[model samples]
Target: MKVLVFLLLIITTITSKGWAQDCLGMTLKAGTSYEMSTFNAKDKPTGKISYQVKDVHKEGSSTVMDITAQFEDEKGKQRTPYVIHYTCTGNELIADLSGMMQSMQATAMKDAEMKLKSNKLVYPGKLSVGQKLSDGQMEAEMVSNGNTMMNMNMVMSNRQVESKAPITTPAGTFDTYKIKSDMSFESRVMGIPIRNSMQVVSYRVDSQIFDIKSETYNKNGKLMGYTLLTKAN
Candidate 1:
C-alpha cells in the first residue's frame, strides 16, 4: 500500500507540470529548465522534480521537445533521471505516456518488466472557462520471469477549465486557467485489487512550459497534497 501511494505521488508530481506547450505562440528552447516542489497534506515539504529541455526539433509540422527529469528528496538526495517527450502540432499539444513510463520504471519498478498501453494526454492551444477536455488513460502490467506480478490502471476524466486566475509561485506570478479533473487508479498486486481516487486542480499558463501550481484532494474534498513551480529558467 505504501509503495502504491508513493507511486501515485510521483505520478501526480509529473503530471502537474501540465505537459503542454504553447503551441502556435511560443517555442520551447533547448536548455530551458524548471523545478517543481511537492508537499504532503499537512503542507510538509516532501521532494522536488527538476526538468531541463534537452532537445527541440521539428517533425514535419509538429514541434517535438525532449526533456530530462530528475527527482530529489527534501534533503537534496537525487534519484535516477529520465527523459519525457511532448509534441505540439496545429492547435493542440500532446504528452507521450511512453516517456512517463520510463520514469516510472526507473523510479518505482526497477527489477520488473513493465508493458504499457496508454492514451496520451492532450491540451488545446486555447482554453476557455467551462470548456470540457478529453480523457486520458494508462494501463501497465509488471512481469517478473514468466509471471505477471502486478497490473495497474489509471484514468483521468471529467476534465474542464474552471476559470481564469492569477497564480503566484516562487517561480513568479502568471495568468492561468484553472482546470479540474477526476483521477482514479486501480491496481492488482498478487491478485489483490486496490483502488484509489482523487480530484486534481491545476493552474496552467498557456505560454509556460510548467504549471504554476496543482493541488490534489481526497473524495471528501480534503486537500491531500500539492506541487508548486519553484523555479524556471
Candidate 2:
C-alpha cells in the first residue's frame, strides 16, 4: 500500500517446513541489512530506503519477522525510522496492510492515530509461473487534532503471475517472477475526495523479501512510477 511508497517487501530468513524456491522469495536471515531506491516516472531519483531484520519468531501458524526501515531523501538525508512486521503463513508471504500502514504513520506523523482493516494477499508455495492470485480490500483512517484527517479504501484484485524472467539490478541479478495486479483507490484526504486506479507490477527474486522492481501505472496506462530493490545482502 501507501506506505510502500518507500518500498514494499516481505522479510524472513526462515523457510517453512514444506515451502521452498517456488512460493516465497528470500529466507530471512536476521540481522542482515538491505537497501532499495525509488524513482519517479521520469526515471529521476526520488529517495533511498533501507531495512534491517530486527528479529524473527514463530507464533503458532504464522512466522513473524520484524524489520526496521529507514528512509533518506535524494540528498541522502535521513528520515525517521519505521518498524514493520511481515507475517508468513508457513509457506508464502501475506500482505498485512494494517501493520504496514501503522508503522508508516507512526514514524511520519506525530500524535496521529491510524487504524487499518485489511484483507491480505497470500503468495502461494510452489509458485506456478502463470498462476493468478487475488488479494483483498483495505480501509484505513488517520485521525489527528480530534478530527478525521484521512480516509482511504483500496481494493486489489485481478492479480496474477504475469511472467518469469531474469532480472538485473544494482543489488544483483535474479531469476524473478513478474506479478501483476489491478488496484482501485478511493480516499478523502484533508476533506478532498480522490479516486484513482492503478496497475501494479512486481518482479520478485526467488526467496527474496522484496521485489527487485515494482511499478505503478495510471488508468491511462501511462507510467505513474516505480521502485527498485537496488541493494541487499
Best-matching candidate per lDDT: 1
Q: Rate the local accuracy (lDDT) of all candidates.
A: 0.78, 0.69
Report the Cα lDDT for residue 144, model 1.
84
- Cα TM-score per model: 0.89, 0.82
What tens-digit string does per-residue lDDT give for candidate 1 at 1-233?
55444444554612224344345576577777989899988989989988898877778988888888888888999877877778888688787655556666776778899888774778888888999999977788888897988888888899999999998888888889999999898988899999988888888877776668888888899998888999998
Q: lDDT, candidate 2, residue 97? A: 50
Pull out the clashing pairs in model 1: none
Per-residue error at 33 for model 1, in Å?
0.3
Where's the lowest-lDDT run of ten residues in candidate 1? Answer: 13-22
